[model samples]
Target: MEPTTLTTDRLLLRPFEAKDVDAVHAACQDPEILRWIPVPEPYGREDAEEFVLRAAPGGWREDTMYSFGAFTKSGVLVGSMGLVRLAGLGGLERQAELGFWTAKEQRGRGYTVEAGRAVSDWAFTALGVERLEWVAEVGNEGSRAVAQRLGFVMEGIQRARIVQRGIRRDARIAALLPTDWERTMETPYLPARTD
Candidate 1:
């Protein structure tokens, strides 16, 4: 799939470009972002360059990960969002993992939530994604909050399911189905009964 763009009322969601390297590099410097996100410790400009100029586009070309850099209307870098194909989506299955990181200064303003909604919509409708899962290392409250606001039902903790900084850790998992947003899809979902 070719790289695409999404526009919200206040932001432009698109692939990271050369000009965005500085902002991405700077944002990764925040202790909070570094603590949770699996970015390089002591992130360097070269690392940012490799991510923007190479790995990001590579994901698009491979049709495995769809990533977007969220920016304000005036072009301030807000954050990054992505969907990694977990299963299916290649032949007959439809599942993906949703991930994101909000810049330190851009937190609490609802930008990541806005971008997440748009991205999720595209994944469900455009990519035919049946299950969009959000997994954050346990205790990442900020990330979990954004997923909830986007209507991802909290599922539960996954034991030793996440590897961060070379160690396995538990994760909080959640998901959003098309029906959560009243969007009808070809694949019918019969969720297990609460009782």
Candidate 2:
């Protein structure tokens, strides 16, 4: 269950490669990345190495998650996104959580949305997931905007449901159902201007 390659009009979502560790390390070192994600602070090369070697592979094989390295046609790792927290009852496992982050230099280009849209499609059609859940720190408007653009309906804020850097934080919860996805269709929104 190695993460497979996914594509959209201007992006390619693929599995992390050994060479991507440096880029991953660089992205993780961003304070915003450390702030929103539950990863170790002062993110270093070792942390990114371990993530690529252990957590990511295990996640994909368990069918519990899939993390992709977001690259451009020329193959530069600009970011990463994942379907995580997958769980279900009986033989049903149709729900998952979505999480992503872009490099500091690439923040405003809608790469997250493009990658997310690609994965959401795979999750629903290829993986048989029925619902995709999203949550972001209450004031993380950037992330919330991506969720909205991906058609995840805001379900509301969860009081102190997220703990970051030893502080309790509120999270905006949202979900996208297969019914809300246009299966036979590709993404319709043009990439928002980065400038």
TM-score for all models, in order of appearance: 0.96, 0.88
lDDT of 1 by residue, 96-181 (tens): 99999999899999999999999999998888888899999999999999999999999999999988899999999998989889
TM-score of 2: 0.88
TM-score of model 1 relative to the true fold? Answer: 0.96
Clashes of 1: 1
Question: Model 1: runs farther than 4 Å from truth?
Answer: none
- For model 1, which pairs clash? 89-93
Q: State in Å the error of residue 179, model 2.
A: 1.5
Worst 10 residues of 2 by lDDT: 182-191
lDDT of 2 by residue, 25-72 (tens): 988988888878889887888999999877788788887678899998
Error of 2 at 54 (Å): 1.5
